[model samples]
Target: MTNKPMVSIVCTSYNHGDYIAEAIDSFLMQKTNFEFEILIYDDASTDQSPRVIKQYENNYPSLIKPIYQTQNQYSKGVRVEMFNHNRASGKYIAVCEGDDYWTDPYKLQKQVDYMERHPACSMTVHAADRVLSDKKKVLSRVRPEERNAIFSVERVIEGGGDLIATNSMVYSKEKVKVLAPFYLNAVVGDYPLVILAALHGTVDYLDENMSAYRVGVKGSWTERELATSLKRINHYHDMEKMFDEINEYTEYRYNSALEKAKLGYRFSLLLEQGRFREAKHGEYRKIYLELGAKKRVLLEMKRYFPNVTESIRKARWKLIH
Candidate 1:
């Protein structure tokens, strides 16, 4: 690992002390022909996360570079992962969070070889195991496609965040720089980054499951934003504005697909907020029709007995979290 790094591995840590060692060890274990540097940004973690990072930095000073933030940047509206991109001195950027670990030792080796051969591909992502964070139970999941393929911009806009996992992302540094300014203000960074990167060039899909996605983790965007009623309303609004920005950026070329994605988010918001009438009619009716018969019936039940539904929802959240 003495030569200049061909890839920069980006990671963020916030109270992930328990899992940071696995993540760091995973990065160190990658068997790549070309050297790669790990850039970990510690968001002033009020936990043992920083200590783990320091130990790794000491052991591999040349490879493990980190920033110990004195203040939390995300709370100040900073798109936190950009910390790695800004300091990136490599041709490609790869991402893995402190709570997520790569399973394959040859992951970087395999991806970089493919990207080196295909200049047309700005990014490449693989399938990953989506596991319950606390239980460590692997949920049956499939993503992108069943085989290797080219992921297009339209497909990216339509699928949003579900199509790609951040831990599985490896993209050209040059392509991402052009998109940074456009998505800097967006509430969520990774989703828009994928969309904008797809606009630059194709995204190669690798069928291999190379990483683990720890779902329902503490301080995760899903838990902090999408798991509640009030937060989800604002979250959906953020989603709406992001779609509008992308549509305009693409000159309405992908308006049809993007509109459908936005409508789904709107439907989710209305249903969760007990606005049954809005969710069952108008633009949302399309999603209602698309749902299975059982789900439609359940939605009616929840609509009529909102108090019961609310109680049930609260119980579920408490049980899970």
Candidate 2:
């Protein structure tokens, strides 16, 4: 292996013992014309993830470099990606969380070739299949609408959560270095990173499905069930903070879209807790008005006679089904 690698694959794990091996093996299976290094960080996993990481590190000494943490830095608000990113000597960085794995062997080769040919494209993401961990069933395919299209910063922000898939993303390391504190400190990583990447250059989409995103797994950030009102509120708070940070970092360039997202989350929180009257006031009033007369009437019905509206909804659902 050369001192300078062509791509750096960064994998973060916390209690992903059962799925770490598959993640490692997937990287090992990549067929590329250039050299790449796998930087796997085990964030003080309470499970057997450390042992699995050790096994791979021992077998593939040159390619797999494992960083076993004694204390979980993520809980302390440490950005593991920053550390892995500093150690990366590659021109491109590919991300795949421990619970997720790549399905195609040519994933790296294709991405690298695309980046080389299109220097203006700061990042490239492909389609991925969402799989439920419990039943091992493929739930859905996630990707943007236009295949092989170049997405501008405004377009990416407008696309919202559908712009790119985290595991399917491979971005230019040089462009990624321009990411601000707003992105590094955000609750979630991928969306902000994509936005930051778009600020530097356009982001491209590849139509190929090359990875599996495992959801509904224990300790999985995106998959865990928010079972309480408090938990749901906390989730929205985090999302709101993320949008606020993005707005500030981008110097209010996408203010309108950001405001819409922030208000959308606030409205969802109010609707979840049955605070309909409060939702009709303040910044949320605009969003409430956008709900149309039918939804507004339904909201009033839900506020005054929740049980009746719920019954009607259930009956309607049953009839439709």
Candidate 3:
């Protein structure tokens, strides 16, 4: 057999000292017939994350390759994943952030088998369980709407909200490398990668839950404590910019879906800050006008009766949960 690995597991880390070991251990525990290498990029963490990664590298010299940075690259507008991407020497690439861990030992093997059988599929993603870090509660079990489903580019674009778990994603490295410039300029990483893979070929969704996506972890990007109204607005604007880039690249093939996503984020921001009147006057005015009569009436109620609206919101949340 050749010395080269068949799959390269690329993990990116910052200050995830507490969780980094679990992520690395999960990769090490994966039982696959073919060889795979773990390429971890540490962005000058100020915690014990580097130490934990060093232990793994020392233990598995042949399987684990690590890059320790002296300066924080993300703050300098560098794409850390691209660094990992360039170093990967495998036909397939599997991504698992340092805060998350694979639950199934067969996760990599299963995805590889599926990709091997379906030559037309550029990517394969499995289901994952989302857990809250502090409470150690499973927030929700996320999966595709259908099992063993083949998703087209249009379909993938339409199912916009967390359709594919990043930790559960495995894609063709050859196809991913040829993605348009928009992918490199994207505000967020995973969504654009999914879109690029879909654009190349079909995407497969396996229903098996194989990974754990920890939310609200300290120093993690998805932490709720780090999100403020202003930050949310800025994030939405960045998303809008990414959509514009994608629209230009795809020649407006998925403009309808992109427009819906843009409108959704704008509306969400408006609702978050209780800016109902502003929503009725800006570029989002068309979206406001397009809202169903019942929804429009609800917004009008929110504007006129803020206290009542807050009470109703709490009640609705209580009912849902």
Candidate 4:
């Protein structure tokens, strides 16, 4: 009899007391035949997050195992996702951040069932609802079109970081043991993980929206990164470097796609720095035309009405994030 857990839930939290309970409860509610363990890592949260985790751990000691850090490791250059992933003891790893929760009680069951039947699939992901930090007003889903399909390594590479939502990811534990140096040193976590999975095996996409991703949470990684122009541009630079590294690592196999993604980032960098002329010309022309009407209008506003554009951006950031 195999006694190991079928799935290990690696959940990371940082001062997410307000929403951590829902995340834990969602794990507790999963209806699956195989055993699953929830590994919650609270990185020295000052909020009630640690307390809430302790309460749940006491109630479900057998299922809920938590690591409560006295000091935040993320701020000290720790790969928080890898830290939690290494401690997990299961055949499969399911990542749902502290701020996000599963909507389907059978989410794990469904993903595991598909993976078991398709051994070549290293990772499985599905559509997920992107909600406001308040947990109301869903913004969108990870897969807006909502169709089941298989994604190849090339496709995943071209899709970029937001290709798959963090909350909706369930991947095989075996494939990640031997990884590239670039993957370990990536500034962003999920993108490399997805690419690594695709390199080894196909990524299966389930159309169901089984999880919720809370966007624009205060102090959250995305919210903080998008807070300022310099930060946003720096974030894009990191992404460009990651893409270049991936290009070299893949030996230019996916160069065409990777280059396209990098071009998009370069265009964004130009826009952030108010280089509208450069952004609208040359190789950047295609991506600019691909932007939606609203986005094009915003770009035009940035060129013609700088003050008005800044005001609208600030208002939108406050309302959305």
All models, RMSD in angstroms: 2.0, 4.9, 4.4, 1.5
Give the per-residue lDDT digits (tens) of candidate 4, residues 1-321.
257899999999999999999999999999999999999999999999999999999999998999999999988888887777887889999999999999999999999999999999999999988899875679877893458899988788878887899888899989766667778778878888999889888899999989999987888987756778989898898888888898888898988888888888899899999999998789998888889889998898889999998998789778875
Worst 10 residues of 2 by lDDT: 220-229
Candidate 1 lDDT tens digits, 71-122: 9998888878878889988899999889999999999999999999999889
Q: What is the lDDT of residue 150 in candidate 3?
A: 83
Clashing pairs in 2: none
> Clash number for every model?
0, 0, 0, 0
Give a tens-digit lDDT track for model 3, residues 159-197.
Answer: 664877899989999877775788888767898888899
Per-residue lDDT value at 32 in model 4: 95
Candidate 2, which segments miss by more than 4 Å at Cα? 223-227, 276-321
lDDT at 1, model 2? 53
Best by TM-score: 4
The TM-score measured for candidate 1 stands at: 0.93
Worst 10 residues of 3 by lDDT: 220-229
Higher-scoring candidate on lDDT, 1 or 2:
1
